[model samples]
Target: MDTTQLKHLLGEMTRAEKIGQMVQLAGEFYKEEDSENTGPMHEMNMTPKKMTVSGSVLGISGAETLINIQKEHLAKSRLGIPLLFMADVVHGYRTIFPVPLAMASTWQPELVEESANVSATEAAVSGLHVTFAPMVDLVRDARWGRVMESTGEDPYLNQLYARAFVRGYQGQDLKNDPFSVAACVKHFAGYGAPVAGREYNTVELSERTLKEMYLPAYQAGISEGSKLVMTAFNSLEGVPATANKPLMRETLRKELGFEGVLISDWASVGELIPHGIAKDLKQAGELAIQAGVDIEMMTGGYLNYLNELIDEGKVSEELLNEAVWRILTLKNELGLFENPYRGANSELENNLVFSKEHREKARIVAEESIVLLKNEKQVLPLTHHQKVALIVPEDQSKDVLGPWSWKGEPSESVSVYEGLLNHISKEAIVVKTIDHSKNDRPKDWLDDVSTADVIVAALGESSYMSGEGASRSNIKLPAEQIQVIKELRTLNKPIVLILFNGRPLDLTDVVQDVDSILEAWFPGTEAGTAIGNILYGTKNPSGKLTMSFPRAVGQVPLYYNQDNTGRPLTAYNQEDKYLSRYLDVDNRPLFPFGYGLSYTQFSYSPMKVTLSKSEREQTDKIIVETTITNSGKVTGSEVVQLYIRDKVGQVVRPIKELKRFKKILLEPGEVATILFELNQQDLEYVHQDLSVSVESGEFDLMIGSNSEEVETTTVYLELKKNE
Candidate 1:
């Protein structure tokens, strides 16, 4: 019956019709000429730009323009197979939500899911049919440029975010939906663990690490019903992930039971020539298709060479038919095949630039994603009555939104100053720092910083500095921005540093010097207001930092859950004796995992586990309860983290692994109970042979503000081997 609907529809398609399903050329790439435009991807493809791509990727998103382009492709193509429009609607579409990294910091699946839901509703209404999102890559090293785009360091959290994103994007029904664009969980296998955190770099990992840590998120995405997957540009075991049949076919499709399509990352199929695996474009096409890459994204790998590769017996016709069927089935599911341009609802388009509700929601997400990283001497939750000098040290126009905020507009975007102005009375002086783009810049925003009661200095990477291709070796603030902060400190006024960046930065100098610091990681269009709300007490800042900030770039790639070595430094004062310690600096990082500061202080009592191992043989339920109290004058939210330490193991394990975390908001002088009900499923980990099972052990339950600082309790559990 399923085949009947798709095959009968396919029977009517001509050669061009079928070919269109396989092609995915960049739709809105910049072109030199209008009449004969090939787009940016053509140069990478080594072909003329005028090629008729089957699917057009609107990497450049403008609702009206995207509709026009898709229409043109449908009209121009010989068989008239309507083009599927795709884009990197990564976080927020138009109304920017927090960056994916910042969202992960919340450790709240509900927020992440709702944010994705809003993204899908907005993007679909804006005329997009598919999104390359939820980029479910598990990143450990913060120095890697793309770290800002992933859920940090843990497979469990990444899985939670993946499932949330998939449900938000596709919803419960895929066979009939116009507003929800089909979710495409991307960079299929091990894209996050690039060597030295470089982009599109080689991945090297043991089979156990790969199975236990790296592969779970992809499995989660598949289980959540993600319809499409994109393979990574990097190679695993020296074979490109895009061309690794074992990973694509064996691990993903067959083992994980994913029946969806596997698309290639941008221009990656043709890149096999440089990878030295394929002789030419034709060979590249043969290898990728045979390896299970169903669609050639912007590379023409399947477009010009697939048929010939099939004729030569390098790729089976069965592969082509399977690929085509997967695509056509999705199209049918989207209701696109029956009504070619089903998503092109003019009413939705007409009313979809942005609305009051969208802006309001953006504000909420922005506020929710702002992580209070450090605040010494209890210096935050600024009052409206206080005369604050909001210094736009970096270009306010540029830094307020932080990089990769595609939806944010300068005037329309909420400015930190605007937020301040709205919260305060007429008496409050909201001074604007001069826009000085001089050849010789000043030390700070202005000389007289001492006069103000408080100061707000905005700093970090400009918008567009830390997403896909934005890799940075030295993760430090620009010299100019650093200078601004240093100069403001001369006045001895309590200063608050607002950092806007995609990835974590090494701010050892600023952290020690500034009174307070806010990590507002790319807070979208409503950034100013969200930040402003937190500063003037409209909203209590509840976000926790997802990635760890390093003291120096030398301590790069630092994360929690790293394996303890045999030579872990035990000597009180010794030189490098092959201990897991750095010689130049301390092995410890400036900040640790699960670290964040609040305006108010939080006290945690020792943890209590209600359920025991004796009753575990039945329905296993571990009810963990911890009391979190606000012991400060101001109100703030705290994220209580629970970590588990395997006291003894057949194999080596990390010092501490995050079991669960709860984000709770508390008023001043208030106490709340935090609880997590974990099942036996939660206790499972890959054995030496690489299958998940819970083994009996004496486990240490460590509760902490961050990974390094912990108050722990011990618990004994009994389970048979292969448990």
Candidate 2:
């Protein structure tokens, strides 16, 4: 539908009907009989008329079920407007892929895009219109459970993944693409950096810091044409994001150029009352509408008080119309008027959901996302002749599918024991799986460990340990698992620790107890298969850490690109007490960002930086070149990272910032020349006044395999004279 048609439809809608379009309810409201007046309807005082005209439904999907619901909803609609179906399809729908953090660790945005495309295809076929996914929050704290949803700590990498997710979900032409679902980039404007790494905690960041670090990925998502933006649940500067007019209207809509529908995260609009900013639910609705929140999800704040606010002149009719207009326009853009059932077909859902082809893609993604953290004396790639003992401290067969997998069946996931059997002969490998909560070790556990030539410990947090409202003060392996590892260390056999987790952990104690450590973060449906492939050398581990692994829990919010302190700790001042160094623990992380291991080794030549012109414009590019050689005896892939350090700036600059990176496959003894081009925008920083500008100065251009290890060369940026 065009603007003229949308305007005509908007004019025809009554005040109640228009307001209804701006409210979203859960699937249960529509699925159950409304005449009963029970459950959510009774709690929210919602009327049957309100349910009939609601613009959108979330937390439900199924081709047949949605088809029935849509038919009933259209029957009651005065204008026959279709209901939009949205769900939290964060990682995958039916065929679960690796969590977003694991996906980002691949350092391959193209693969991430493919994974998201598969998710969109499966979701659309199941009758979902929007997926609240590609959460581009910049996470530096592992204690925050939602870190599993974000890309990583770096703004540049997050930006790449954000665009990839948007493109994958919406496809090239959303209006004509029935197999694609509209992407909703979520938790806009600093939702990741909560205080104490706690869920829904307050975020206090300076405007400059927020713009420089937290806002880029969101801007990247909007620039890539994501159809919807969900507000964060946390408050910024004491104002809840759902009710912050300056943030939603000025920063997001005006500055970020996001003209799409802005929806509240779950019941964040109603949460404004608890936030102490709004006196009651009525004021919460008033403030939310005033802040330009187009849709209130799972809340009666908008439905119960929006009309009253308009009647009392607290909220304008123009605001209500604009909000409803955006929602209607989105529905039109999705081609819902022409086909309310978008891609709903039971036959297609059965044929496409968790298809063999989709599972293969999931396996490939999971394979690439498995990071090899430690390999002492190359104890991995176990020989088939040697007997192996697969000891799992907990029953992790179902736990392989991490959090937010509402539709995924845990029974379908592949366990490490199952994966080992695929590679090693069943007779050569013994398996001992026990529940840690039972406090009962298998009677044959020690006997199995003593006879095995090698031990593989599959352990980590459960699916319930991470992702949203599951934050932990101690981000480490449980005591029982650690004790089991320590006990296994007495066997004097080589131990390989395979971690299935959602976030980077404090591995101070476990690193010493294991000969090899593979960080296999919830490898989705093909978990066991991917681990088996990596373990047996069918696939070399190439995934890098997007988030740093801290040595201790005190370093909760650790990252590579940190600014220098006035009194820095250095080799020259190692003994000084005045320096900014911890007395008990080292300041550096146990493993830095871009840190990973491959079966083969990669050596980098000295970096070379050349300017296109000595004095160049802001848009001119600077070329950086380096050569990487696979110095080891096997074929492998390497993530070559390029970083930059500004000598001086308007504001203090980080010690190192990741500007560009590439994952390249190299044969044994083969060498590849890597090239990266940087521009003035890469050096730009948000000043104290919140204005982005690049200063002309010297920058250290560094290229390496990871953040901590680099070969550096100096380059000067001489800007052209301008008014």
Candidate 3:
């Protein structure tokens, strides 16, 4: 329904009905722990479970329990205001696909989208209505534990992902789609740039970076018909996002024109007191309500004191109703109110949820997303005939998936040992040396590696290690993991480190200690076979680094595109006293943006630029053409990156900005012509006055595999510099 319909429907509602729309209760009463986990969770505190509430934030359970929990909600609440059920379906809910960072490394938008669809399918079958996913925060700092949740540091890439994940979750229509669910674009704004990449740390961003580099993905989600927009935990520019009218009303709703319901991050409303923004709980509720937040999650301030705030006139009834109207509209759009039992399809659950077809797609998505981080000497693609020693953590059989796989079964999962056994014969010797604990040490495996043809060291954080509040102060392999790898390397046996993680870690030593590294971010149920295929040389590894592998933790927000300072040190050739340079290390990042390796080598031909005003049909149009060839022995895929720079702009444009990129798969000795259309839009940059414009003088365009390696040409646009 439109706003008018929502408003009319809201006008007829009683105070309780209106309040119900704004309240989001925790999901504990109906979710049984089943003697599996014994934790102090509020969900387990409820005596007789209430079926219907504002929403259900499932407190960790599997498919059956999640569905039963929702069924109770629909069967109980007054007006049957069909409660919305939401879970952190970050990468994949049950099938446990790769974490966002690892998935981003793949650089395949379609595959990313497909993975989200699979996640939505799994959650929907379990009666979940929404997923707080596709954490589109632009992160430059790897130290931030939440990097696992984001797409990467670049805004443009996140924007592409924002639309892709939304399409994957909820397609053209949502009311009748079984695989679709409303994708709640999260952390609203500036949550990724936390100080020192610490959890819930304050962010201080310049206006230009926020708009150009951070906000595009959020806006993209809004345009893609996102039904809900979640507020972030951190404050933006001095205002807590839960109560910041400028961010919630003026910017998000007014300027960007998003009409969806505004939901707060967990406990962010009452959190205003800690941020020093609100005097008390009542004030927190009043400010957030007036600022246009429709649904409050966890913070009891709203459910308890909002009526008093309304009576005091601190929050207008109109403002409250507006929020209620938006919330109700979303519920209706979700088809919850029309048919309260809309999602409780027991028949569908019997057919779907981990079905063979769904599992097959999970395998494909998992396989493609496993990025080969390093494969020096072309040592990978191990033979089945060789004697193999698979030395992994004891949890390897269980945590083939890193995180968010409560509904996923490891029995259904293909482990490295099982996969190898399925593919190889008795002639091949496969040894397994697994000791789950890091403290006990795997010293016995050191001798095992020397006798083996190759060593596969599979290690990483147990899925629960680095997500949400799971941010770490130190981003490195566990001590025991480091020790095991160090010992294995002494054997001079080929070592492959299979990394299972939710985010990027400081793996500099691992990069050097092993022959190759495969980043299989919680590779779901099909991890075993997918990984086996890569090791046995069936699937060529095409994944690249989405976030950089920093040389050290001190290099927290390092990236390729940086600005030139007043006294920028000239490379290693120039001597400097105290310049904008690191005394201990080079200012350049360990790996530049768009850096990826392939099994086969690819060569970029010299670039050609045509500058006839008539040929381009516009004086500002600059077209660049380049040829790329697979110069090595095997088939592989490469991302052709295009960057542009204005020789002189009103403001200091980035040294170079990513303008375009294309993922092309090539067979051995294949050559293809790649053309990038250069328009004035491609040349746009944030100016001194805070507007995007194309400054005309000399614009240099370069095409290459990564940022540093470039083949270039120029087309000077001698037009009026945009104001």
Candidate 4:
């Protein structure tokens, strides 16, 4: 449908029909039994007629179910407008991949893009129109359960991932592509910085901080042509984002150039009442429509009260028409009018869902996402001849497919014990599947542990421990699991801790008990196969920490790019009382961001910096080059990171900020000169007044394996005078 057709559809819609287009409901509400005024329908005061015109249905997939529902809905519709189906296809639909946090650790946007394309392919065939994914919220606090959904804390990396995800999900032609699904970048404004890392908590940040730190990723998604944007549950500066007009309209829509449909997060529009901004659902609907929230998900705030508000002149008819128009435009763009079933086909779904080709891609992605945190005296790459004890909770392996994998079956996931059997003989490996929660440790378990030359202890938080409302105050291994590790340490055997988790955990105690630690963060369906390959030298671990692993839970919001305080503790003033030092612990993370170990080592030579001109203009580029050599005797991959520190700024700057990074694969004794180019935009920072600026001053250009361990060189930037 063209613009003229969409306008005609909008004009043909009645006041109530237009209001219905701004409402979204779950799959259960579309059932034949729901036609009667009872259950959720009665609760939301929705009539049979109103249900026929709902703009979208979420949490519904599978080609057969959606076809039946859409057939039923269009049959009852006066205008024959099809219902849009959306779901939270965060990581995958059926062929599960690692969580977004794990994907970010790979630092390979192209690979991430491929994973997303696979997800879109599966989801499109499964009857999904939009996927609320590429959750580009920049998360610093690992205590926030939703950190597993975001790319990481860095804006530059998040921006790269956001664009990649949008490109992959929407493809080159979203409207014409059957394999692609419209991507919805979520929680638009400061959703990740919830106070105390608690879910749905208030977010208090300066406008400058919000734009500088959180908004870039969402902006990147929009710039890459994501079709939809979802609002955050948290309030920014006492205004809930669903009802925050300046944020949704001014910053997101106008400044960021997001002309796409803006939908509220699940029940967020109705949440404005609890947020103290609305007296009732009517007021909530008024504020949301005013704030430019086109669709209210899982709530009847728009359907129940939008018409009344419009009748009372509290909400404009123009706003209602615009929202409905956008919804119609999206349906048209999806080619729903021509073929309401889009790409949904049960036959295609069966062939594509968790197919061998898709699972292979998942295994490859999961392999790159496993970070080797510690390898003392080269304890890893276990020999097949040696006896190995695989210590794990009986049911923990099934939880490898983490949260938001609505369609993935845990039973299909490969277990760690099974993964080991792929490489090592079953007779040589003893699997002690003990319940970690049990108080009594069997004598047989201890005897099995004593017999092994090396203990591969598989442990960490379960799928339920992290992701959406699973925030924890103590971000560490459970006490029972810690005690089990402590007891195993007495065996005097080399211990390899294979951690399965969603976020960066405080590993202060575990570091002492284990000789090697492999951070295998919920590696989806092929979890065991990927870890097995890495453990047996078939594959090298190249993943790095996207978020810092705090040494203690007290450093809840620890990140690499933190601003240096006025009283920052320096090496010379280490013992100073007034400095910014922790009284009980060191002010360093267990492992810094971009910190990961490989089976082989790489060394970097002194960096060389060259300016395009001696007195560089803002348009001229600055080139930095460094030679990285595979110093060890085995092939490996390394992520060479480039960071910049501005000596002076209008506002205080972070100690260092990651600007560019490249992942290079090198053979034994191979040397490669890595080069990076930067301009004034790379050096720009958000000021207190919310204006971005790049000052003329010296910047410390640092290159290294990680954020903390870097070699530095100084360069000056002199901007040309304005005419």
Alpha-carbon local distance difference test for all models: 0.76, 0.90, 0.75, 0.90
By lDDT, the better pick of 1 and 3 is: 1
Pairs that collide in candidate 3 are 28-43, 51-72, 51-73, 52-73, 402-463, 402-522, 414-528
Clash number for candidate 1: 6
TM-score of 2: 0.98
Candidate 4, residues 1-723, lDDT tens digits: the string is 878888888888899888888889988887766665678777688777778888899998999999998899899999999999999999999999999999999999999999999999999999999999879999999899999998898999999999999998998888789899999999888899999999999999988888898889999999999999999999998899999999989999899999889999999988888899999888998999999999999777888888788789899889988888888888888899999999899999999989999999999999999999999979998888889998887688688999878899999999898999998788888888768658878665788678889999999999999999999998899888888899999899999999989898999987998999999998999999999999999999999989999989998799999999999988788788898889888888889999999999999999999888544345378899999999998899999999999988889999999999999999999999999999877888888878777778889999999998999998877854323
Model 4 — TM-score against the truth? 0.98
Q: Candidate 1: misplaced stretches above 4 Å? A: 12-16, 29-53, 60-80, 425-446, 570-578, 613-619, 633-635
Model 1 accuracy (lDDT, Cα) = 0.76
Instruction: Give lDDT: candidate 2, residue 452.
Output: 89
The per-prediction tally of clashing pairs is 6, 0, 7, 0
Instruction: Go through the candidates in order and give the C-alpha RMSD of each one to the true structure.
Output: 3.1, 1.5, 3.5, 1.4
| Poorest stretch of ten by lDDT in candidate 2 | 612-621
- Ten-residue stretch with the least lDDT total in model 1: 30-39
The local lDDT score (0 to 100) that residue 309 gets in candidate 1 is: 73
lDDT score, candidate 1, position 567: 77
TM-score of 1: 0.92
Give a tens-digit lDDT track for model 3, residues 428-487.
655565564436644564564577788887787776677667777677888778877887
Lowest lDDT sum, 10 consecutive residues, model 4, at: 611-620
Worst 10 residues of 3 by lDDT: 42-51
Please, what is the TM-score per model?
Answer: 0.92, 0.98, 0.92, 0.98
